[model samples]
Every structure is written in structure tokens, then in C-alpha cells.
Target: MTSVQQRTLYQWFEESALRQPDHPALEVGDEVLSFAGLRALAMTLAERIVHKHGRAPRRVALVASRTVAAYAGYLAAQRLGAGIVPLNPDHPDQRNLDIAQRAGVEVALVGGRSAGLFARLPERHRPTVLELDEDERADGPVPEGTPPAAYDLDGEAYLLFTSGSTGQPKGVPILHRHISPYLAHNITRYGITPGTRLSQVFGLTFDAHVFDLFATWGGGGTLVVPSATDLYSPVDFIVERRLTHWFSVPSVVREAQRLGNLPLGRAVTLRHSLFGAEPVTAQHVALWREVAPASQIHNVYGPTELAICCTNHRLTGPSARWPQYPGGTVPIGVMFPHMEGVLLGGDGLPADEGELCVRGPQRFDGYLDPRENAGRFLSYEDGGRAVAYDGSAPLTDRHWYRTGDRVRRVDGVMVHCGRLDQQVKVRGHRVEIGEVEAVLRRHPYVVDVAVAALPTDDGETELVAAYAGRAVDPAVFEAWLGDQVPLHMVPARIRRLDGLPLNDNGKTDRNALARILATREGS
Candidate 1:
């Protein structure tokens, strides 16, 4: 029997392969790779890495998208006990190079489409490139005694880069122990089995992809990859792929509703549907239920610092029975059984509504840059006052990670409010942007909306809104909005767009909307 300390992320897939060698493990378009087949490919790639570097690298970069190289390369890195660093081909070359340099990536695995992108890397910071063709051919077997120790629970599994407030990317490294419990809990919670088929909608750059990969592989299930078009029409993909499980950002549901692509009760094969990385509205759930009538709907919430997700809410019974909260969004439910959470008020005291702080097995140790850890954690005193961690002492599990998002407890369930930073002052009145957006979404003509506070020439901030749906007269909409909320919440300028811009993670890009509003204000 494998001890808990001897478990690695790669061991999950290896176990599935031994149990069900012929089971279909991955489905990329028409190509389906069985568990045994994928294991062989990963072994071949791992051998290539060892042969090129004379040993397994400490970190490897994956510059591929939804290609076979991406999936196989991920497993290959795990097999060699190397930390995986996934790069986006769509990002600027300098940005990707900066990530590679920061992570100290020794080798890069490139797919056919990303070959040009990898070539753009300067030799000074560029890793040794292994161009994987579409055929996925292997050169030779790995020499004996080349592979490193396969199991190390404390070893770093992967390193991810997220946008920082300082105009740079912050590195977050997740260890195998930190993520093992997450995978174990979800695989059983979702009823994953060899017959289950899961959807892979998130890109490698997003942390949500961690669930799409390990959870499915660990349970001996199939991971079905979708194409670019499939994302816009997910209902069609769900029916065609015969997927039993589906997960993506809530924006996909809104886009499908806007495009009229969700047919009534068409996704009969799906058993579970999950939405996260953004707040989910009741309307999104209602529309999705119309299509996947028999599927269990869930809204999961978490930050990258807390693994994939720390809390989840399942919508059971009818729509009327579902818990409705302020901001017209679904409840975030409770924290996982293995974790503990507390809400801190503005005065650093315990409260029913405030910043959510958590501490548990799933919480990461700290950011890659020690400087980024300042003020990101909290230590509770005997009197229950939360003190901000100033890095005066060694960081320990006793400290709780401060998730910047605000939430309130309703009927013992946590409901997400807007982020603390999203609370902006307009004419000396603090207004929550999510509250404004929630009100705007009530209008029959509005499908999706994003409200931003932009700077004015007079050095004051004002509200501006960009909405996607039917074009309505701005004056009429503003008057209707003013009647519902205070006058300050109303936007000074309203713009109608065919659709709101989405970031790589499929969430509404508020920064891009702010830029657009600023540019239009100048124009």
C-alpha cells in the first residue's frame, strides 16, 4: 500500500493505468488515447527530457495549447518530479519569456501551433525546445537509472503566474501535498468513475484546469477537450461528446443564452454542471437548467492561493427552493469539511460579513516571491482580533490566508459580495460595483453588464457601464435604474456592445472595459 507521504500527482494517473490500461483516458477531437497509450507517450517524453539534460529538470515549460503535447507534457513533467510551468501562446512573447526566466525552466515542450511562439524566445532565457509533432512519435527509451525519485509529497508540483497589482506577474507554486486533498475530495464528491466523461474547458494557464486534469485521471475517467468553437456552443459539445460532467466559467452560460444556442433539455447525457472563477447569477442557473434538466448544478468558489476551490454550493430541488442572496447571485455555500474559515469585519474583529480568511491543508505555503506575502495573511489573537501578518516571524499553518473577496453569511451559508477593491468611492459615497451590476442585470433588455469606475478630468471617479444585450435608450435605462437604486449608482455614460470582452479565463475583463471607457471618454 502506498503511504500518504509517498503519494505524487503522477501516481494518480499511474494507478489508473494499472487498473484500467485499456480504458479511454483522453479524448482530443477524434483521437482517443487509452490509459496505457497515454502512459507510454508520457514515458517517452520523460525519457526525452532526461536524455537532453542528462537528468530530469527542476522545472519545465509547456508552450502548447489543447494539443496532445500539452497533456502528455504535463504528465511527463510529473513523472520526472519537475515543476510544470504552463505558458500561454496567445500572450506577448516578452511576457512568456519573463515567466520562463522567473521560473528557471530548463526545457520547453512545444506543440505544432506554438512552435513559432517558442522560437520567439531569446536564446539567453529560452529553454531547450522539444518540438512535438502532431503524430507524437518517440525517439527511444530512457536509459536505466535516469529517472528521479517518483514520489515526494512535499515537492513542488507546478508553478503558475497571475497578474499582480504592481503591473507584473506574481508566481504561485503549489506543492503536491497542498493539492492532494483537493483531488481526493473532488473525485469522490463528483462520483467520478471509469465510465464518467469530464469536460476540459479551462486553459492551462488557469488554476481550474488542475481539477479538469487530475480529478478525471485519478478516477480513471476520460477528459474530453473542446475546440474554440465548442466553447461558444457548449450544449452541442456536451451532447456530441457524451460528457457526464461539465465545468467552466459562468460567462459561457451567459454567452450561450445570448446566442440562443441552448436548446431545451438537449444536454441529457450530462450528470453534473459546475461554474466558477466568477460570480454566478440565478438567471445563469435557470437558463442552464433548462438545457441540462437532469444535471446537478453547482457554483464553486476559491482563489489560486487556496488550491482550485475551497467552497461549493449545489442547487437542489426546484428553482424556487434554491437559496437566493443579495446581488442576485447563488450562494457560495460552506467551506470544505477539511478547512476552517472566518469572516473579519473592517475593525479586524469577527463578523458575519467582511473579508473571508481561511486556513487548512489546501492553503498554499506562500507566494514564490517572499515580498509578495506582505499583508496577505492574518494571525488571530486570543481576543479574536485579526492581526495582519507583517512577516516578522516564520510563516506557519496557524496563519490564515486573506482572500480579498468580501462575503456575508446568510442562513449559515456564505454569499459572495464584490471584492474589497471593487468597492469604490463615488462623490464620497462608497458603492459596490457588484451591487450596481446586479441591478443592471434585472433589466429585461440587458444580458450581461460590467460597471467600472473611471477617473475624470476633474480628478474624481465616476461610474460608467458597458452592457451586452438589446440596445436601449440610455436616458430611459438610466431613469429606470435611478428608481431602483440611489442616484450615485447610476452610470454617467452607458455604452452598448455586442458582447462584453472576456479574459483568457472566460471572466468579464473589467480592466479592458475600463480602458474602453477611458478611450471613449477621451474621444
Candidate 2:
């Protein structure tokens, strides 16, 4: 029997181990581990962690390369009731510190060959770092015995630092209660009852990984974690692993189709392909039809504040093309039944088309940054905290997370528009316009700057930065920026502006920037 307090995650791990001991749990190029072996490794690492952290659930900073040990550490952290704060391995050493400090990670879990890098970090950001000896893989003394575990769910599950509208990195705390329901919902929704084979292509930091992980294990499904190389090289990896289900970004599907790298000519045996993170454009749909036409392709939609997939749209037939979701609003199907949503206008009252406010079983408690949390969640009975009722007091205690998205409610269907906040969704990651502007302003030649996210094709959003500088070459500044920010965070297009256009309130006029871009495009 599984302990209810252990959360469904623990039970899933044990169940997968018992039923499919020899089934491969992770496949990274030449490396492979059976389900039983992976679970045992997770258990050994979790015990090692508890001993190092003094048997308490403390938020731990985990840094590792894109491989199996990284996967193991993530599950181990969860088993010990500790939230996982994943530091992107590619990020500059110093930049990682700023986020680590902000998230208040008490210890750093270093894995794989980079195990020694933790000690090199600056004191301020470097907590008491712990390096696991699992890389050795040598068997420990004594026969395998069931050891006591200290898994708790009430603690923070993960601390995700998202770019705030003001260039400040805001920390969101994902709690177990917030994630548990979605796990249960998707497990039943996708029918991952038992002996199911699942694939994991996304990076662990992404919220999609939660769905990929839980939906598989909670219902006794076998997980297959593919390496980054194997992710793009689909056939050798997919066919060899005999993958049955996968959750992938649209870009991967398109790239695979373009390269003819998939076994799409008929041998493809995908049961279902889940896609999300950004808009699923028509260009991406064509790729879906080409490669895995027989598989059920589902477009998932949900913000990180909510659990992985709050809503999904499954393509019913194989179509050569898809209608682009029109601008003003695009229906993301309906709520998960367990989840509910409402469209509210500026007055804090319900409206046919306005702000997208969500209430559901998957709603997160609040952000790690409490001040931001107050603004994100509210009781519909009470005035939404995001809007100052101008002067009206709040109504109730049921919490709701403000999606910060522009959505319209038409005939009971929620239509997603653009965002109301200065946020950008590039690829699948959220980039705060303010953060990019701040970094641009840091350039010695830069005097003023503004950044914008223009929606584009293939579910991909483009990032363009407009800045006024000291008459220096834009390429020089762009190259300098590459050293400071992650490659993904770098602006794709850079334009030198004489000065940023500002409105009366001392805010940059984004409309003017859009108009300028439009005028240029037209010319």
C-alpha cells in the first residue's frame, strides 16, 4: 500500500519498479537504465540527500548536464519533500547565482561530471553544496533493504523564477496540492493505467515535464528519458526504444519532418503526441500530419502557475492544413471539467471578453514571491487582487491565478488573445520584456532600449530589441550580450533606435514601437 501523504508520485515510482523492473526507464544515446534500476538509484540518491540535509525538507539548488543523473536528482528531491530548483547547465556561472539567491536555495545538488562546479560559485549565491557519489555507480555495502523515507507534499515542489514585467525575476512556488490533481486528471484523461510506455523529450525545467512524468508514473506507465541528441534524431532513438507516447514542442516535430529524420513512412507507432508551450500554428500541424499521422495529436494549453495541462484540443482527422487561430481570440477548447475559468473585465466583474481568470483543482497556492502571489490569486466573491477595485474591498477566499493573458469569452468558450502584461513567450519559455530591456541598458553604448515579442509561425514567438546606443555597431552590442545571457534569452533581431518613445506615465509606448515595426515592414 502507498502512503497517501507520500503524494501519488512516490507510489508511481514504486509501482513502475515492481511491474516493469527490466523495462528501460531512460535512454540517452548509449546509456540505458531499467525501471527497477532507476527507482533504486532514485532511492539511494534520496537517502544520501536526506542524510546531507539533516533529514528535513529544505529547498535544494540542483545543477547538472542534460542526462539521466539530472533526471534522477529531480525525482530524488521530490521523494524527500524538497522542491527542485533546476539551474540551467548552460547559463553563465554568475547569472545562476542571482536566481539562486533570489529563490533562497539552502543547498546545491551537483550531479554528473559537473559535480565540482558548485564549489566555484560566488559565496552569496552558493549555499552548502552537496555532490552525490552516484556517478561511481559502484554497489553499496549490504543487501538491498527498504530504508525509511521522508517524503512530504505540503512543502514547495519547485521554485520557478520567471521574468517579471518590470525586468525583476519573480519566483513562483509550485506546491504538491496544486500539482496532484492535474496528475490524477491526466492519468485518467490519457488512460495511462499500467504497463504504458511514455517518452520524455522536454527539459526538466519546463512545466510540461511534470505532465510527462506524472501522467506516466501515477498510472504505472514506464518512462523513457531521451538525451538531447536523441531528441532530434528521432528514428534511431524512437524505433530502438519502441516509444508509444510522447510530449514534444512543435518545433521538434517540424524539424524532424524537414530533415526526413523520422520513421514516418509507416513504421511510426506513436500512440499520442502532446504539444504545447506556445500557439500550435498551422505550419506545425502539417508536420504532425506527415510524421506521426496515425497518432492522436493533442495541443495542450496551460500556464506554469497551473498544473501541466489544464485544457487540450485533439485533432480529429488528418488534415493537410490548419486554420491559424485568428488574432482577437483563439479557443483552447474547454476547461478540464475539474478546472473552471471566467472572463472578467476591468471592473472585476464577469465579462464576455476580458481578462482570463482561472479557478480549478490544479491552481497553485501562490508564488514563491508572496507580494506577486497576492496580485495573482483572488476570490471571485472578492475583487480580484490584480485589479484595484479602485477602492472596493475583496469578496471571498477561493484563490484564482490571473493568467495575464488577453482572452475573450464567446458563448462559454475562452478565446485567448495577446498578453495584457509586458511578457513574451519565446519558443516555450516566458521572457520578461523588462529583463531584456534592463540587460540592453547595461551595455556601455546603449542609452535607451525597448523590447517586444511579436507572435510568429510554427508556434514560435520572435524576440526583437530596439535600442538607442552611442552610434556603435549593433552587432558589437549583440555579441557582448551573448556572453551575459543564455542563448535562448538573446534577442533574435536588434534595431538601433534614436530614443524610446514614452507615454505620459513615463512608460515606453509599446503601441508606438509596434507602429514603427509595422511601418518598416510595409516599407
Best-matching candidate per lDDT: 1
Give residue 291's error in model 2 in angstroms: 2.1
> In model 2, what lDDT does residue 71 have?
66
TM-scores of the models, in the order given: 0.81, 0.87
Tens digits of per-residue lDDT, candidate 2, 74-122, equal 7777766677788876776667777777877777777656566656766
Q: Find the candidate with the highest TM-score and give its number.
A: 2
lDDT of each: 0.83, 0.68
Worst 10 residues of 1 by lDDT: 137-146
**Model 2 CA lDDT for position 513:** 86
lDDT of 1 by residue, 241-351 (tens): 999999998767666766877777899898899988767778788878888988999999988889889999998656777766898889999998888899999999988
